[model samples]
Target: MSRCVLLRCAAAAAVVAATLVAAACGGDDTPTDVVLVTHDSFAVSKAVKQAFERESGLTLRILQGGDANEVLNRSLLTAGDPQGDVVFGIDDSVLSRAVGGDLLEEYRSPELSTVEPDFANPDPHVTPIDHGEVCLNVDRRWFASRHVPPPKTLADLILDRYRNLLVVENPATSSPGLAFLLATVATYGDPGWQTYWRGLRANGVRVVDGWEEAYTQQFSGASGSPGKRPIVVSYASSPAAEVIFASKPLATAPTAAVEEGCYRQVEYAGVLRGAHNEDGARKLIDFMLSERFQADVPGSMFVYPVRAGVPLPEAFAKHAIVPRDPLQLPAAQVDANRDRWVARWTEIVVR
Candidate 1:
């Protein structure tokens, strides 16, 4: 769900203060706190947080270290002496970089046995929590009002009609942005991806720093005041969020994801190396994989739980899309080429 933090109104301070205040009021004589350092997109209902704290006998503290890339970058800088016990929201887009930098401590959870094999991490270092597809989400209303068909594939984004109608996050700063860039690479390959980016630039695509700005400000399909851009880089599950969070109860979402060029993203959590509360950290990871957590995933974060049998919410079941053949590049390939690709992308699109 962190592919696009679905809670449009919740602020980072609000999420932190709520969790911290609950921990402070807890009646434990000597409370042991396990810190979870993750992206700003992380969210869970208060009930779920209280349940985890009570069940595990651990005070759960959260440290939202910005977006996924910011979280990973901060962890890499303080690799051994991490700021928290567990780090969540590091997806396949940057998982190899985290492992290569020795940012996580290996702690294979028993809960992993129930995870869908497709979402399982082969390495014991990280546990997959949830998965989703990052795709171009369009405002169906916007297209309809203009009497123009929305773009359906990566190739369609560069068309003349869609010019200045698409907004994207900068891959260097955002995970979904990076996943989208990888999607282009997986779709167009090498020189072709570069050409595609050049075409996008020529077609007047707008690039923002992160998902929040692109989706909430520039994207037309968001709940509040609509922006000019009809299409944006966002999650496949975003439509479900739109329907659930709408001002009024709606039968359907105003937005829809173009599944043809979607990119699959699997978010993971792991114990940080040299954590003060390693035991508590492992417990937190296990709790994340528990049914209570996974079951709340769709409503809380707008992502599909990695646990195979977790049922989806009505909104997700009705409005969300699961791409049949989402685009993906192996972690090793992404890790090796990420820097060069980002630099080239900046050159083509930003510079």
Candidate 2:
């Protein structure tokens, strides 16, 4: 889910940029504030924010740059002169764009050693921060009441019995949507994936602009919303969010993730190229990897921290399902095919 947020373009005079360069080159003193530009889904706890500020002696300013795609696109437009010191939420699906554009400074946080080995990036410009799985979430109660079995895999989605029961976000506009699209691509080869999508279109799958609409307004599984569709494309951790945010104690979550066809999405943070506060930016990246921030990640953003051995929240531990074998596509393959795939997908499914 993303809301359009205005990004302030960096348009300072060359003299001003040179002054910043001089300050960065001659600095022992950290800047008073460090800006973090991230997607709308980014969140942090007040305690963690305060702790980082106290420890680093700098204020952390976060700017929401719509969704992951928007954030990346905006950063590319201002590559050498970024709008913020640090850019967060560059995920595996679109990482090559950031790296290829030279939008980030090369400064691998020492904290990278603490990250899970699977998420380690060979690219030196960014450090992994958090990860999540995008998969189908079914309304358990909806199927139970109707005496119908819930869908368990991508192959089941196009069955006649489940017709018109699923809602998905548009891949061109949403991160989870794009992940789901990539999952299909990984599951089925290029042409085969197109065939599967044709089946989905024939079976009456509905599409929305983003996750918020599909999950909150169209998907019956979501908490406290009267949505008609029984299944939605959303995060594997969404079930935990339901349990954690429930109005009253419930025995179990109403929704559950379908492990098959799940896609792993690992997000990263980097120091923007030519930032005014390079030292502060690096410290902020370190703070994100620290246990204090990592511990708060699950509850705040419904995603798992990349830092190894950080304890999960009780609700998340009990409800969120980590896929045994989540699908993945090489960053290079995805970067090369993303636009073509999205366009082809639109023609087949949307148009």
Candidate 3:
């Protein structure tokens, strides 16, 4: 099926499920199953799900609610009659809104003790599962063939030499785009971010709607067909993913992330406020933070585990460079100013 058709079908299913959940909330027909509502990117091994169900004695259901923003918005809209028992993929960019809306029930997991102290939940409403860096991925061959040096910093993107060589996702539509925008805001501050974006626009930076198009279609690094743009806004782990998914295993990645422009994104999972199976929801959250799940994270999700001592896949350890000081804005600041920033960004960059 076509991608648009698939998205439409998924959306229709979500709406129908939401209606059923609303009816269940109004009546006595509470669901016995523990439903996990998450973004399209969420994944877990079948073994993991089976183990959770076997131990918890509750049927597990997963709902892919479009994207991170969509999933969070759906949970907020259905706060008291949530479509699922647990919600995952709420990142730092949207966490404050979820907390402020009272969409989640506070349940601190005991498994958190093994997670890194830096990622510890400051608020009990949500628990961090995995983290990744949003950064610029460069096509090594693209620059090497031309004997041109790759841009090293955000400032380098707007240089005359780099014109028409970069592609970025739309902040209003793409998670990585939003994260990258936030990175600029954190790096350059409010007024400077607008200036930087204007410079990029003048330098011929192309903006696409989402990561898949930006990476697979426009990015010369990954596109199997003829591609133009050499630099794409993507994940630090993207290089590792390229190596892991290659048809014939690659000794090294063809793409590399520019660590200087990286933005840290931490994804969280929380029990919905009025879930039918709160105990099971809590168990699911705990399981996500467990060693077994953390071990599965790198290969399955291409993200770093939040658990302190979990070993990374060899591909990630060798190819991905975790930024020592990734740019980040406070959750409250992002929550308060996100819409305005996105709007201004649209005006400057998209228009």
TM-score of each: 0.89, 0.91, 0.90
Minimum summed lDDT over a 10-residue window in model 2 is located at 1-10
Instruction: For candidate 1, give the lDDT.
Output: 0.90
Q: What's the candidate order when arranged by decreasing lDDT?
A: 2, 3, 1
**Residue lDDT tens for model 2, 1-351:** 223222222334565776875564454454678899999989999999999999987878899969889999999999989999999999999999999999999988888888888876558999888989999999999999999999889999999999999999999999999999999999998979999999999999999999999999999988878899999999999888889889998779989999888999999999999998898999999999998899999989999998899999888888889888999999999999999999999999978
Each model's Cα RMSD: 9.7, 6.8, 7.4
Clashes of each: 0, 0, 0
Candidate 3 lDDT over residue span 235-282, tens digit each: 999999988888897887999999997999999999999888888899
1 versus 2: better TM-score goes to: 2
Candidate 3 residue runs with Cα over 4 Å from true position: 1-32, 223-225
Ten consecutive residues with minimal summed lDDT in candidate 1?
A: 22-31
List, residue by residue over 1-351, the lDDT tens digit for candidate 1. 663475644576688877865664453434378899999889999999999999888888899967888889999999999988999998897889899999988889999988988876556899999998999999999999889998988999889999999999999888889999999999999878999999999999999998989999999889894588989999999999998888889997999989999999989999999987788888899999999999999898888898988899989888999899999999998988999999999999999
lDDT score at residue 215, model 2, on the 0-100 scale: 94
Q: Point to the candidate with the largest TM-score.
A: 2
State the weakest 10-residue window (summed lDDT) of model 3. 23-32
- Native-to-model Cα distance after best TM-score fit, residue 13 in candidate 2, in Å: 13
Q: How accurate locally is residue 252 in candidate 3, as Cα lDDT from 0 to 100?
A: 77
